[model samples]
Target chain A: MLAAERRDHLLELLARQGKVVAKDVAADLGISEDSVRRDLRDLAAEGLCQRVYGGALPVSPAVADYAARQTVTPDGKRKVASVAAGLVRPGGAVILDGGTTALAVAHALPKELSCTVITHSPTIAAALLDHPRAELFLLGGRVFKHSAVTCGAAAVEAAQNVSADLCLLGVTGVHPEVGLTTGDAEEAAMKRALSARAADTYILASSEKLGTASRFRVLPWEKVSGVITDADAHHPVVEQVKALGVEVLTAS
Target chain B: MLAAERRDHLLELLARQGKVVAKDVAADLGISEDSVRRDLRDLAAEGLCQRVYGGALPVSPAVADYAARQTVTPDGKRKVASVAAGLVRPGGAVILDGGTTALAVAHALPKELSCTVITHSPTIAAALLDHPRAELFLLGGRVFKHSAVTCGAAAVEAAQNVSADLCLLGVTGVHPEVGLTTGDAEEAAMKRALSARAADTYILASSEKLGTASRFRVLPWEKVSGVITDADAHHPVVEQVKALGVEVLTAS
Candidate 1:
């Protein structure tokens, strides 16, 4: 096959399965493992995929800027957000992480419900201004403008000062093996700190984020209470995650 | 003069000057103090002026909603913001309080200059996102949605954790006698705590706020470094505030 045709075939496999293992793709395509590795390397260079040890995972669209992230699988984000928002009990406190998905969770919350929201994102706090009943607490630290959230030693210290009933966390990628991950190291630390302050932490992952892997690891799967996503319930990765006793919630 | 004309004349005096004393207004119009007091009562009931002891002062338009306050005095706010922005030196840290005027100061900052900004207003921090090099710290507390600022004990505690070289404060009223005031009591405490953390504090007062009074007193003239205003330099109230040894800066 032509190199370009092989690359297109590999791209098609990644788009369909969310990840492509070199050995598996090589066996299925009747090509050498070295050729599959070459194709993966070329795809990674083009910013189309994230290359791991033996495979390539889908690059999360959540790593983009404020506007770009909003347009990535928006319907799936809304569905996941609605499920996460349902976890908040009236008058209970929740620690909310920063990102486009978390912002959608803020919008999905019920209007009349009175709860306490603790967040490090100024953008989240700004949105909660119109919320009539929720009492908001904003954490102070160095502002990470890319995500519009506070992240630093100060932010972690502030997070320790308060406890919450639940935490709605935003992650760029969620894979059974690679665990939870985000784009920035500081933001990853901030997310971990926020999870430590809450009784239960639920990962908010839109459909596209499932089985993907980003650069920074946030937490081990054992630390999270459940996974919320709009991905297909029958997907093998979702089933694998569920088999580990980590509750998998289908938003749709 | 008829009672209607007398009330109109009183409003005119308020427009010309920033306040009106009953005894003075009565004398100027060949009327009794009771007649001036009656007119003042009617105006106060109509929300046209703030009724103070022995007189009435101009009501601060700042007490209005966010959109309404933005339209109160655009030119005056910009002038004061420019002067306040000048006080921020490169690489210096400053504590910025929340309000429309303070938001303007965020906009007035030079794009190429770098500084550290610690603020309680999410709105202010959001505006600084596009700024190339301002390290932002957002203090956490209960959200005061009316002004988009954090206040109460948590905010005061957060303010004490970090110190700044200067504090650019926002207040609804600035007067020689009333000192500094804002619409909310908790916000007043937060502003006082912020001022204490900074080496010097400058009050950002648009021309319309001069001689006006709000419900809560934030600080005394002795606590502030100076007053930045676009009011006429020769205005008697400005001169009186200056005579008290408090520096009054004319923005225009």
Candidate 2:
């Protein structure tokens, strides 16, 4: 395979396997380990992969800017997003936050699934623009340019008006004790408010985030009814999450 | 004067002079009162004039949006905005909300004036795009298409990050005990937040907004430091506001 195609294949393998050794990826694709390392570094910079001492792991929790993270684990987020999207029922009201993980979920949604999506993310709103079955209720708030998400009093107030059937929490740090957390305080507040009104909350996170923590706490594991990840994620971490009584789905 | 120019002049006279009786406008323009009323009706549709039982008064705050208000009373808003803009000291950061009144103030800013402008209004940001001397910070959130402004969690969070020398609250309902209010609840929250962080707050409202109230209350009289209105507005309501020690600037 061409170097570019090999790199793509290595990335796909990493996503499918959740992690890949540089030597193995290089040998499998007939490329040098140095090239695999360079590819891993590039993917990490884009927030797609977590590079370890010898290999790369797929991004979890979709917990970064969509533009940056979307390019990171393209195949993995897509597969995970597709599996999560299948759970959404038609004519239901959904609240989508601005996060790469959420965008992946939005992208995976079938065109014919009818629902009302309330979101503060401009990117998600733009994606839903072409969705024939989705009725969009865009919440007004203060705009955060970097994340392309709305947060603050206005966003909180608008969210209070919506009692969503489901709220897809994206790019969050999940811990057994801490629940779900994010990097920003304002985002946490908005997420808390969204969760308060949501009938069911599902967290779309990758296994890499299983033990890590961020600055803002969104919710506890008990609040999240479902957890979705890729097939190749660490078995022990998946088991730990499953012990929390949350239905864990893996993208095959 | 050509018919268009004549109509423009007539509108200007009504705006400046506050109200122009049908007979007087007819006499001034050498047209019948019936013809003048016809013009008044046309202007009212554009939100430029207020048709009364006998004649027409200038379009007041209640009847117009910021865009329409700007077009109807260009000279007055400019004069008021210019005076208000002059209050800005050098090397000071200022917060401006989305409203033509605030837009006028931005327009009236001197080219040599150096300050950082933080705003969530795309319209205001687009307006300042050509101002090379000024530094601009756009607060992000979900875009409000009607106002072209972003408000919510993102905007409020961004606004909370800064402390400004001045906050120019846009036109809305201005009352004694109830203070300032707006038609939009989300906007009201942002306006209130902006007011809280500024060292000084000024309400850029027209004379007619005095004593009126919107559904939402933004600030109390004690919170607002100043009010600016047209010079000709001399109602007892103006005196009532002045009695509270809120410095009132009248634009002649």
Candidate 3:
């Protein structure tokens, strides 16, 4: 296919699948992986898609601010949240990452299921109050106003002391090659610190985040135990994630 | 199963039954009695449960934290908060204490109002997100989960740096003779420290707190600038507070 035709095809795939892996696109379209990367970079430059390590995602304004993100794909987020909440074993310790999706997980948690919830987001901590059986530990640090979560040296240090069974990570982007990503550098560091302290880490992202890339990388694909999204199990992104040896869970 | 998983199972039992004996946990988990005791000891140390002579008991039945407290006398809290929010000048800095009442004030803030808000509660900070023009500074410390606010030495140190135009203080008890008080000693100290940093401090309480006394004294009645409550301004408690030379503002 011509280069223009290839780029158009890639955008179509991204629009339909919510993500496009460079390697997968190359094999399907008989193009070089380098050509896929070039097209993705061009698209990112044009503000059409965001380029990640090995894939590109549809451009999302949600990364610009927390308020805008909350309004985007609300139903998808609720679905993703419900599935993620199911992963929590009763009475286990869960480290909740900050974001709208994680907040949704906190809301979806069963009121009678006793668990210890540790989070740096005051919002998530507050949501857990309705869960009468949940014990909450709020990590303290400099509050990042944009995200409404604490992030600083103190927050990172505090996260290190918590050894949780599971970490429900919220990310702005999830790419097969770029892994998990967010907007701020310090916040990304804090998230990495949090994930390091947990035995099992799952990234909670709606379909909108699939194949998207943000400014700061949080975890590599290998580090994540699973990716829970609102997409179907047979979706292309899910297939790509599974091919990477990571479990994929769909809310639908 | 991992030791941590086993411990989680024991906690689940404690949540459902309120208490668990070592022998019972051992038999249920197919583990030894000694293992159960060790788990109970570890849990107790973490403050997840209370260790008794036998096994363990769920942490104190009293839910005095911010979330639990939010449901108690909510109408009264809304009255108090509405009055407190009205007290804020259009562009002045306000120091907010951590509690259900203070959180209500955050929510009651007018969207068009512009101001700076300094707070130790993550929940309060999150609430202020709706106020687009408000600038928020969150204090750092060990999060006192019960109140959904930061406390301890670090939180106090952080509070010292902020000089606000007004402080909205939340307390568990506001007595005519005993003054302002709360449940935890460190939390009281943090509240006192926050009050000292603000130019003027107002205590937000409902009728239930008017004549009650808590464990830790946060301030003397003489130090508070005003007492804001849901009771009538002519009520006895209002008169008592006014006699102490503190201004009293009632919602109705």
* Candidate 3 stretches greater than 4 Å from native: A1-79, A142-146, A152-154, A250-252, B1-83, B86-92, B139-165, B183-190, B196-199, B205-216, B229-252
Tens-digit lDDT track of model 1 for B1-252: 335445656675675456788997775554689988998999999999999998987787333233343456498898899899999999999999899999999978886779999999999999888787888888987889899999988888888899999999999998899899988899999999999999999999898888999999999999999999999899988999999998888988
What CAPRI-style quality would you assign to candidate 2?
incorrect
Interface RMSD, candidate 3?
Answer: 15.3
Which segments of candidate 1 are over 4 A away from where they belong? A1-73, B1-73
Best by DockQ: 1
In TM-score terms, which candidate is top?
Answer: 1
Total residue pair clashes for candidate 3: 1
DockQ per candidate: 0.22, 0.02, 0.12
- In candidate 3, which residue pairs clash? B65-B146
lDDT of 2 by residue, A77-180 (tens): 66677777887888887777777778878877877788877777656766665676676666555555456666788678768767788888785577767778
Instruction: Report how far off residue A33 is in candidate 2 (Å).
Output: 24
Task: Give the per-residue lDDT digits (tens) of candidate 3, residues A68-165.
Answer: 22223255787888899899999799999988789878877887999888888878877776576777777766677788888888778777767899
**Chain B TM-score against the true chain B, each candidate:** 0.71, 0.69, 0.71
Q: How does residue A212 of candidate 2 score in lDDT?
A: 68
Superposition error at B30 for model 3 (Å):
47
Provide interface RMSD per model, one decimal.
24.3, 23.8, 15.3
Docking verdict class for candidate 3: incorrect
CAPRI accuracy category, model 1: incorrect
- The lDDT per prediction is 0.85, 0.72, 0.81
